[model samples]
Target: MESTSLQPASAPAGKFLSRFLIITVTICILISPGYIFFSERGGIGFIEGVTVKQLLHLIFPFFGLYAFTLVWGQIIIGTCKPLIKKIFPGIGRFHRLEGIFAFIFALIHPVLLIGSLGAVTYLKYEFVGPNKKIFVLLGVTALLLLIVTVTTALLMRLPWLQKRWKKLHYANYAVFILVFIHSWNLGTDIQGSPLQYLWMFFAVSAGLGTLYRIWRAIVKRRTAMSAQSATASEPTNSLNPPNS
Candidate 1:
């Protein structure tokens, strides 16, 4: 007899390394577009009138530092599930931790971005920047998603909020797209580089992967329902066995 929550070990390849690798790979693919394209512009390109080299000098380190952190986040979620499970004991809570980590990273990302720009703006008055208000609003929305997703991870903490948190987390997809669009609109350097194409390639791949997951989930649900239905009908038909 199999328990509902605990399954036989042979159910599937639920190994920690496998899950970690998949999640890490997915997140890397997800972040690659933004990081790769945004990276090249350097510091001078970001600042209003600095030469490309100067901007690169100022900006590259900050960018590199964050990229290092971002890659770690991916690896933690993708490859380190076993460790997480060891620490947390249960699947749901462990899963929530993943969301929490993602939220933390997302929160830091925009803060550093805005802070860096603010510093630059204070340092020089080379050009009037675009509507920082709009940028901030979009950024805040992204941050909020991380916050909400992290909050929802407490399934036992707030059961009613579980569905809501999940729904809010879905907004991350929207946040990602908006961020990219905002970057494209404001990314002056992307105008002439191959970066845009590469970004698009990664973005499309990530989106398609998400869609693929959705489809697989739906198929699994349908299969489950059909199998249950068949099992349920077995006894009824056996009593009066249907005519051939």
Candidate 2:
């Protein structure tokens, strides 16, 4: 007999909360374009007679920024999973969903940019170095890494590949750094706007979160090593007792 004992009443509530978070994040992403459009009026050319291509071009940064936010949220939810579980036990489910949307918005950013400016022109600006070449290259590199990471994530559902998922997911950190550099340097919308400072705040937050995780890993490793050494020493000491 299959028992329902394995699940608790909180399971449904947790699932509901996870879904609510996913939906809220999605709504935020959708509303960003309108917010940025109105906020930047002349800068975004939202006055009148804006073509679809122009609109997409104007909205590109918002998508890119939102993508970063989603991935950053994934990092936060993951790094603090234990704490998050204590509060919202099922929130872990949102981790994968955030990654999925991050990749989607990231893919859209470049597609829209290419659509606004033909492929050749886009590539020229992105690849050919006049001065801003480095920032463009950083963005391209991050996008390529993001593609691989997300594809690997999807592949993780396969039983054979599950073990390697953690290793592949580490690429997200590198992607975050690359995207941060690219956006901070070349983000026109961020320049001289409140968004610039907000972007910086996120950058610092992500950086600090990453550093703390690395520190935790180091401390954990050292603790494990010390415990192993003590255990090994105990066995040796028993074999050769110190004179009393």
Highest lDDT among the candidates is held by which one? 2
Q: Write the per-residue lDDT of candidate 1 for residues 97-181, one digit (tens) a residue.
A: 5556555555555445445466565235222365545644554565565455456555535767755765655655665565555
Error of 1 at 77 (Å): 7.8
Which ranges of candidate 2 are over 4 A from the true structure?
1-37, 42-48, 126-129, 157-160, 240-244
Clashing residue pairs in candidate 1 (N, C-alpha, C atoms within 3 angstroms): 20-78, 20-79, 24-78, 43-55, 43-56, 44-55, 44-56
lDDT of 1 at 50: 68
